[model samples]
Target: MGRSPCCDKVGLKKGPWTPEEDQKLLAYIEEHGHGSWRALPAKAGLERCGKSCRLRWTNYLRPDIKRGKFSMQEEQTIIQLHALLGNRWSAIATHLPKRTDNEIKNYWNTHLKKRLDKMGIDPVTHKPKNDAILSNEGHSKSASNLSHMAQWESARLEAEARLVRESKLRTSHSSSPSLQHSLIGTSASSSSSSAPVLPSSTRYLDHAWNNGSSTSTVATRMSDLESPTSTLSENNVPPIMTSVIEFVGSSERGMVKEEGEREWNKGFQESTTHLGEYKDGMENSMPFTSSLHELTVTMATTWGSSTTSAHAHGHVSEDGFTNLLLNSNSDHRSLSSEGGGDSNNNCHGNSSDGGNGTGNELYEDNKIYWNNILNLMNCSSPSDSPMF
Candidate 1:
């Protein structure tokens, strides 16, 4: 079959939209959403084609669209994301909430591109002009790593976009007109102009590390934007999300994977602050695959029984998953391994527990196991990231 045109262009307005046109488009969308962008113009009483109406609304009239100059942080993010993503503007736009892909494309063409040229940097490769002289092996290795990370990020963004698209569809059908208007209004006003408010699907991704919505030290559950009473949540639409681990005091202390497991376990046991308790409310937060969910349950049970000392010392670590994995009494096994029968030996084989040779081997194995899990969570898995 041949491709279809976005909209019939005949006899439709093509010039810049006036204030009245913008108001009409915004009001209609705020009330009914731009449900079927191909049909929005006729319903909204605009003379423009649906394609024009969609572009107008998304690029300019949308309440959440941030207007005017980009900040330094945003510029750095754009440059970094561009270096990784090349010219995939929509993918880059996912990282930069509220900023349109069109705006980013334009800004790059006009400003950032010139700035890089002046500095003798190749905008395409995001490298210095003389980078050709650098060692091929080093450059290739770095490029390979960057490409891998970019692929991982790109796949994740696509998944999030798909889930959000589905959620929006369900929301459009279920939400009342009055509720939709209030949601866009609250979303527009409540967010401090500096902070980005993630769309509903972002709850599937790690909010702090990926989205960075909140500035407060305490990492809270999906904000008012995810509240059931909010516009998006009208009619009891379950948060069509599965991830979003909260990272409290994440910036204050860096997570060092190389640290001895026993040492870190001690620190976790001694810490007074308790955070990320998985309660009934969190039943829907993770919604892991059935196998992984069962594994989590097993791990959590083992950790609970063994953490009597942790309770005596005070509170535990920041998150339930962290606490479980960090303090599990059973021997650590790779996630690929199903049953725990063979790997019953503790990874934290203390010097006194097994003397020198065996203890060192177990210790090394423990580090590798932790590294593998951490890398898997942060890189391989799309649904979760290490939250600490």
Candidate 2:
């Protein structure tokens, strides 16, 4: 099939918009409305092509556009959404209420992209050079870990989808009495009562995970195990272990029991000093034991037994899990790998435990990671450069 021309070859202006053209277009749009762009230029007495007029109004002339510099928060949101959505500028723009896709695309290309490059990050992958260096430190070990994590994530997602479908099917069948009657009453009742309702939108996962919504409970549990630590050490010890210990010690009796005793003594002295008010208040006070018990239970569920921990971590098929983790490591390696001949050069630098130069490389890699995060956090202003 032949493609159509963007605009007619007749006498129509096609460069930057002039003030006169803007005024005529704006006045015409305000009074008569822009019902059709192709017909708009002639109706408004402008020489410009309809496309040019439309682009001018939508990008530059729109009253709702925020013309000033972008804020830090706005920049961060853009970076994060961009990471997830890639170069879908229009989609990203929709999330930023007062921004246009053209403006965002320009800013990312000129400003944010350059900044990330200077910081030693791949603007496209959002990763550092050392990732490849570390990956090459050990072939089999890193690959295995990468594969395991991937399979785990895949299995978890599959389980979640299955649960959702099952819930939906049960809900549909329950709502239809003839369908339910085809089955035994006991079976129908159990299915209807057990099936949970899912939210209307997939984006609702954010609120669901944070607030412990029914639909998100399984996913949230998995997330807690897989992502318990914000920062993993080079030694491979989970950060959540320390957090759990601190929480246990603090809530139960303070890390040092002496501190707890001292606080109790101080409270007693204060009560004696204000005897009249203290007696009334003290009568209604409950023991802190119950709160401590709840905390202990939560901690146990979060990190204690191996079986529950595995369940909470969610399942991953061996092959998919291996592929996921390997891909992450591959992403790192691909960025660091210089050429076909450089494989030996890359492998000789570090060890898997990072005991050699691997730790230093990982630390450097982490620095680049943080820098990208910071840049993303501060990337709000629209760039003056042309969009890709």
Candidate 3:
């Protein structure tokens, strides 16, 4: 004979548990502690099946259950657990005392996961989406120096992709001084409208580990057209690709506070007419500069889940970009004279798909394609950043 179902009888209740059912389950558990969930509902006089009773009790009826918004602490824990457990929500739920497996699963699908995407973090690989496309050549010893540089370039490409998507939508309307002001006005308004939406603060990532023992910062060397002395609501579509690389160390944080912070804040404050005025070489020469080495990034569109495919591979059809020639024949160099390497001076980034796509359509297509690059440098990026 076939094995009996857990709830073989018909008309067992399911779906959202009712308050009276919740009360019955709670009262029964309190009076005669539920030793076996499979037999609890019938003994407790509940119409719900064993499965539904177990779910209701574990997910909602429990006295200690914590509901409402998940705290950042809880979010971090869930992310770390999910990374280890994969889709084993029940196993993952063990660590979260008050949260049920279903609640955790829902949060992962609906909330925490989306935040990771917006920051260009791959929820699965726990790295940047661009890292997987790397070939053996991109990981060679000589070419490793360019890895972090490649990450920043990839992020810039993704950011530019956002601009491209937004600009196309903003077309047909002219960008005037007053109009630009108005665009900036309702930035925090709602999700329904497009342009004037501020770029995410993932522009720089500073990851501090073990109580400031070591710090890694990845700063995107924004192109002249992409800087804060600009406005994005303009009708013009900026170049699809540009590259600049910078590494910030912990020691330099004080320097930035004293010197660079002022200039950084000034650029955002001094918004001007960006009528294609940001010439290509405005930040010295293309592909490399005196202060920072430029890596010319070339991108290709992979099969993706984005809303727009018009320029999924970007306007540039070429596979390789010149002048990004990173012929690093030298061995690994250190920032300090001592044996210690400059953790801060290294480019900090990750490889993988973003986690925070949500209802937005450009979730998968937004990944940066580094035609041939691997993770040569370990940029321990801690948090996503915007210009702020």
Candidate 4:
């Protein structure tokens, strides 16, 4: 069956409403709420259709509706909300209290849309025109890696959130001794009757324990409070390890001795012989900066030997950057012991006292380039960022 029109078109008066008609509609609605717009026209004693009457009341005649030019704040609010919600004007209207969806739509079309277009923003996407153009470029390998990391972080957060909710639920369930005991009994019986099931937080820990030979990759470093776990896979996705690792690392590890602790002990204990040498090597390892300094010097020396350069001896050489970093440490010690003034800084050569402007510029550009690479490398590890 076809849906009926809001009101019959034959007898209805439409378009601009007269002042007399507006008064009649407003008076009726004020006395009794505008219930069922289909029936409102007859009850309000107006020739206008119910849809027209409803629009007039909601858009203009409503006492709460703010009629005036949109303020700077309101315009900004509309633009932001439009970006999020798109053409759903009714949804946007909810956020901008006292404004009608119709009014906002008109304002955006007549004013804001043209302004944003002039400023090189895509009104629909609310992003720069240049960004939109660049976005059309296909995803790179680095983009794929970033997406994988993002998915992992999202899953970790979601699992942690679920664990919190369950913890709260458990706390509430434990408040009544009888209920707690009953629930425990039921869970025990069910587990004993069938295969034992684990909580989502503990499931990954169990998987890690059982799968002893699974290799662990360090995506993130361990905190002071917790030791990092070996990664376990189910369908090749890393399992939720955050809460389980925290629980195991905390004082609560002692409580799970019968179940989790035994499996955890047995799993890692079997690999101790193979890991012993690695552990010893770690204990004897140099600090990261010292290790990096040595690596950089070795790499630069090799690179300089392999490649040809036209630069003069005093200018920044291929190996000069490595030497610069190496000298910085020695200079720090020298500055501490002797006066800071007399040391001949080989890093800058004569560039320190305003000689070799071109060399200084080249050095600065190289410095910035290397610093950007180092920053990108640092960002690859989740442990470095607080957001992760």
Any idea what lDDT model 2 has? Answer: 0.39
Candidate 4 C-alpha error for residue 60, in Å? 0.7
Who is ahead in lDDT, 1 or 2?
1
**Collision count for each candidate, in order:** 0, 12, 20, 0
Candidate 4 per-residue lDDT over residues 1-388, each given as its tens digit: 9977866678798789899998998777666656568788999898877889888987888765667876654565566445434675654554454677799999999987887687556787654454433331111221333233323333442343344335434643545533222222111112223333334443443333333212132112112113123132333322222211221110000011223434433432332222232223433222111212222322222223311121212122233223443334334224321332223332221112211223333233333333332222222222212112
Question: Model 2: per-residue lDDT, tens digit, 156-223?
Answer: 33333343335544555555533322221111122333332231222233233222234224344434
Per-residue lDDT of 146 in model 4: 29
Q: Each candidate's TM vs. the true structure?
A: 0.50, 0.40, 0.36, 0.38
Model 1 ranges off by over 4 Å: 135-138, 141-145, 181-388
Relative to the true structure, candidate 4 reaches a TM of: 0.38
Scored against the true structure, residue 60 in model 1 reaches a CA lDDT of: 79
After TM-score superposition, the amount by which residue 66's alpha carbon in candidate 1 deviates from its true location, in angstroms, is 1.5
Candidate numbers sorted by lDDT from highest down: 1, 4, 2, 3
lDDT of 1 by residue, 280-326 (tens): 22221211111122223233334334344334333233353444544
Mind giving the per-residue lDDT tens digits that candidate 3 earns over 260-344? 4344224312221110122221221111010011121112111111102213433222221211222110111111112323333
Q: Evaluate all candidate structures by whole-model CA lDDT and list the values in order.
A: 0.45, 0.39, 0.35, 0.41
Q: What RMSD, rounded to one decimal, does every model reach?
A: 16.2, 21.7, 23.1, 24.0
* Model 1, CA-based lDDT: 0.45
Among all windows of ten consecutive residues in candidate 4, which has the lowest summed lDDT? 247-256
Clashes of 1: 0
Best by lDDT: 1
